[model samples]
Target: MDKHLIDDIKHVSLSLFNKNFFGVYHGSISARVSASGFIINSKDTILDEVTEESLVRLDCQKRDYRWSMANADVHIHEHIYET
Candidate 1:
């Protein structure tokens, strides 16, 4: 994972925490790692516990780590990649 993206996730997750948007294990966050790929929170993992290493890498064409993103709003990321 890129340091910048890890930082972004930290900031976004902290912001969500501040807004009471996530509880102990409630929400997930993800970001595009590249034009054809993304790194998303692992399935069932809590937002507060997310770390750079825990973010699973996924390639749209490969679908290798698709299950890792089962808990996230993957369609949004897919749309972003599509556009």
Candidate 2:
């Protein structure tokens, strides 16, 4: 992903946290990286404390766990990518 886009995601995440839109353990954020993949927040990640480690890359077609940890709602994210 582009450095600027990753920075934007981080910026928006912090904004959401500040507004209480996403609590420490309650929300997920994602961005489409390709036609078949995206980068999403990990399960239990605190939106207010997101780091590069907090993001997990997933491939919609392969359904592979590119990262060691992933969100429970990964399938939903994948479904969105599929369409």
Candidate 3:
């Protein structure tokens, strides 16, 4: 993830946490990197305190992740990849 974007996520996470919009470890953030790829915050890391290195790279076609797997809708990513 880009440094600025990661910083933004941290700020947003802190805001959301302060507002009680999501529990400490109940929420996550994701951003599209390309049609077939994206970077998602790690599964166990608290969003508010997540760092750039804590981000995980996911490839829709390969169903692979650098850190951990997520149960998100694979079809959505596939559709984007196809498009």
Specify the highest-lDDT model's number.
Answer: 2
Off by over 4 Å in 2: none
Model 3, residue 72: distance off in Å is: 7.1
Number of the candidate with higher lDDT, 2 or 3? 2
Ranking according to TM-score, highest score first: 2, 1, 3
lDDT of 2 by residue, 33-81 (tens): 9888899899968888777778888887775546447777777777788
- List per-prediction Cα lDDT, in the order shown: 0.72, 0.81, 0.65
Q: Is candidate 1 or candidate 2 better by TM-score?
A: 2
Clashing pairs in 3: none
Quote each prediction's TM-score: 0.75, 0.85, 0.71
Whole-model lDDT for model 1 versus the true structure? 0.72
lDDT (0-100) at residue 80 of candidate 1?
Answer: 68
Candidate 2 global TM-score: 0.85
Compared with the true structure, the alpha-carbon lDDT of candidate 2 equals 0.81
- Give the Å shift of residue 76 in candidate 1: 4.2
lDDT per residue (tens digit) for residues 50-69 in model 1:
67766777777676546555
